[model samples]
Target: MKIAIIDDNSFLISSIKEKLSFFEEIQVKYTANNGADLLEKLDKDHNLDALLMDIEMPVLNGIETTLAVKQKYPQIKIIMLTVFDNDENIFNAIKAGADGYLLKDVNPHELFNGIVDTLNGGAAMNPSIALKTLKLLRNPVDFKDVSKEEINLTNREVEVLEQLSKGLSYKVIADNLFLSPSTVRKHIENIYSKLQVHSKLEAVQKARRNNLI
Candidate 1:
C-alpha cells in the first residue's frame, strides 16, 4: 500500500517510517514537514492510498490541510495521530472527515491495524472517546441537550475550530500537533455535521453565533 505522511518533526516521522520499514507491502511515497509541502508533492501525483496526519503545525494546521485535501482528493483515507485525547480535538477530527483517530502512545500493532482498517473502509477512534461520551452523558450540557446534534462532531472537530479561529493552515497546524495533512481533513467533516452547517466559513460563523466555543 502507498502512503503519505506530513508532519513537522523529522524524528517522529523517521520513527514512524522505521516502525513500518519491515512491512514490504507498505511504501512511504511522500513525506513533508507541513501541509503545504504535502500539497506541493500531491500536485505532481495523487496516488496515495492513505495519510497519517497530526492535528497541529506551523504553516498550515492539520485541520485546514485535511479540508483542502479532502476537497481535492476524496478517495484517499486519512488517519490522525495525536498526544491529546480531549473531547474537542476528537470531535473536530471526526467532523473533518478523518477515517480514524489514534493516540501517539498507541501500540504499534494497534496502529498498524488502524491503518489497515481505515484503508479498508472503517472508522477508528481512540478509546478515550468513550470516556468523553460517558462524561457528557452524565453531566449533560446547559443548552437543552443539543449534545446529540453535537455528537455528530468528533473531538477533533472541536480542535480544528479552536485552531482555525486562530487562522492557521493545515501544514502549520499539522506541524504543531505532529500529524500529517491528510488526516487533518477527516475531522472537518464531522465539525460541519455537528454544527449543522456546510463549509468552513459557515461552520465557524455558526459556532460563533451559537457561542459553541
Candidate 2:
C-alpha cells in the first residue's frame, strides 16, 4: 500500500515513517510539510493510495486539504492523523471528506489496519474518535446566539440538508431523493456557500438555530 504522510513537524513525520516501516506491505511514498506542498506533488504524481494527514499546518490545513483532494482525486483515501481529537476538528475533517480518523499515538498495527480497512471501504476511526463521532451525530454541537441570517435554500436543497442531518452519505441521499450523486453534491456545495459554513455539523446546527430545517 502506497502512503503519504503530511505534517508540519519533521520529527512527527519521521516518527510516523518509523512506525510504518514495520509493515512490509506499506510503502512510504513521500512526505510533505503542508497541504500546499502535498497538492503540488500530487499534481505531478498522484499514484498514492492513502494519506496520513495532520490537522494543523501552515499554508493549508488538513481539513481544507482533504476537501481539495477529495474534489480532485476522490479515489485516494485520506486518514486524518492528528494529536488533537477535539469535536470541532473531528466534524471539520469529516465534513471535508476524510476517509478515516486516527490519533498520532495509534499503534503501528492499528494504523496499518486502519489503512487496510479504509481501502476496503470502512470508516477506519480510532475507538475514541468513533465514539465521539457517534455522539456528535446523535447530538450535534450547539451554537449559541447564532445570527438569524436569512439563508434561502431551495426545497430540494432543504431536502438534501435534512438527509445530511440524518448522517446519510451522498450516494444514499441521492438514491433516497431519486437524484444523481453529482447533483446532490452540487446542491450541497450550494448549501454550504449560502449558509457560509464549512461543515455538515455547522450547517445543520445553524439551520436548526435559524429554523431553516
Candidate 3:
C-alpha cells in the first residue's frame, strides 16, 4: 500500500494526500512536482508499490513519466489522477501504460478502490473514461495525429507550408501572399528549420505527413 503522488500543484498534492489519509492501509511515500522530479526521487528510492500521477505538468508530463517508470520499474503500478477527461488525454495515458485512470475529483472511497484494483492486476477507469476507452477500441485514433501538437507550428507557418506544397516558386508565393520575395525566403528557411527538412519537397512531405499543412 505504499504510494507516491506526482503533481505540479502543491494544493492538489495535499488534497490527494488528505483523501488517502482516511485509509490506514495506504502510505504516502513521497510527493513530486513533475515527471523529472519523480524520476529523480525514484532513482534515490524506488521502494514504492504504486503512483498517483497527474497528467499536465512542467518539465515532463504524466504520460511520459509513466512510460519511463514502467520501462524501468515494471512492477510498480501507475494510476493517472487528473482533471482532464478528454478522449485524447485518456487515450494517451492508457497507451503510455497507465494501470488506472481516475479524475482528480474522484471520491476518496472510489479512489482507494481504483488503487487497489490496479494493484490487483485490474484496469481502473472512471465510468465515462471506460466508455471512452471502449469507443477508442472501436475506432482507434491515429497516434500520429495525436502528436501533431508537439511540432506547434504557427498559423502563418502552416499557411506558408500549404503554399509551398502547391509547388509555387518563392517569388510567386510571396506575390500571392502580398509579401516580398525575401520575406518568403525567410519564411521558407524558418519552415525548413522547424520541419527539419532540407528542401521544399521534403518540407511539404513532412508537413503533409504530420497533417500540419
Candidate 4:
C-alpha cells in the first residue's frame, strides 16, 4: 500500500516512517511538513492510496486539509495521526472526511492495521476515540443553546456572514461588499470568535440556529 505521512515535526515524521518500515506491504511514498506542502505534492503526484495526516500544522490544519483533499481527491483515504483525541478535534476531523483517527502513540501494528482497515472501506479509530464518537453521536451539540447569552454581531459582520452562508469565496464576498479580501477575512475571523466556532460551516450553522442570518 502506498502511504504518505504529513507532520510539522521532522522527528515525528521520521518516527512514523520508522514504524511503517516494519511492514513490507506498505511503501512510504513521501512525507510533507504541512497541509499546503502536501497539497502541492499531491498536485504533482496524487496516486497514493492513503495519507497519515497531522491535525495541527501551519498554513492549513488537518481538518481543513482533509476537507479539501476529499473534495478534490475522494479516492484517497486520510487517517488523522495526532496526539489530540479531544472531542472537538475528533468531531471536526470526522466531519471533514477523515477515514480514521489514531493517536500518535499508537503501536506500529495497530497503525498498520488501521491503514489496511481504512483501505478496505472500514473506519479505523482508537478504542477511546470510538467511544467518544459514540457519545458525541448519542448527545449531539445543540448549536442554538451553545451559548446561554445572546451573541451580538455587527451589521457589517452579519452581511459578511450571510455572504459566507451562500458559499461565496472571500474575494467574491469582498467584491459584493466593496471591501478588500483581507477585510472580509477579518470579518470572518471576528465572526468565528463571536460565534465561538471554528469553520465556516460551524459558524453558518450556529448563526442559522440562533437566527443571526
Residue 137 miss distance in model 3 (angstroms):
0.1
Error of 3 at 13 (Å): 0.5
**Residue-wise C-alpha lDDT for candidate 2, range 133-158, written one tens digit per residue:** 99999998752323554689999999
TM-score of 1: 0.62
Alpha-carbon lDDT, every model: 0.75, 0.92, 0.90, 0.92
Root-mean-square deviation (CA) per prediction: 13.2, 16.1, 10.6, 10.0
Which 10-residue span in candidate 1 carries the lowest summed lDDT? 143-152
Candidate 1 positional error at 125, Å:
2.7
Error of 2 at 77 (Å): 0.2
Better of 1 and 2 by TM-score: 2
Segments in model 2 whose C-alpha atoms lie over 4 Å from true places: 142-213
Off by over 4 Å in 1: 130-213
Candidate numbers sorted by TM-score from highest down:
3, 4, 2, 1
Candidate 4 C-alpha lDDT tens digits along 85-163 = 7677888899999999999999999999999999999988999999999999998875334445589999999999999
Superposed model 3: Cα runs more than 4 Å off: 146-213
How many residue pairs clash in each candidate at the backbone level? 59, 0, 0, 0
Q: What residue pairs clash in candidate 2, if any at all?
A: none
Q: Estimate the TM-score of every prediction.
A: 0.62, 0.67, 0.69, 0.68
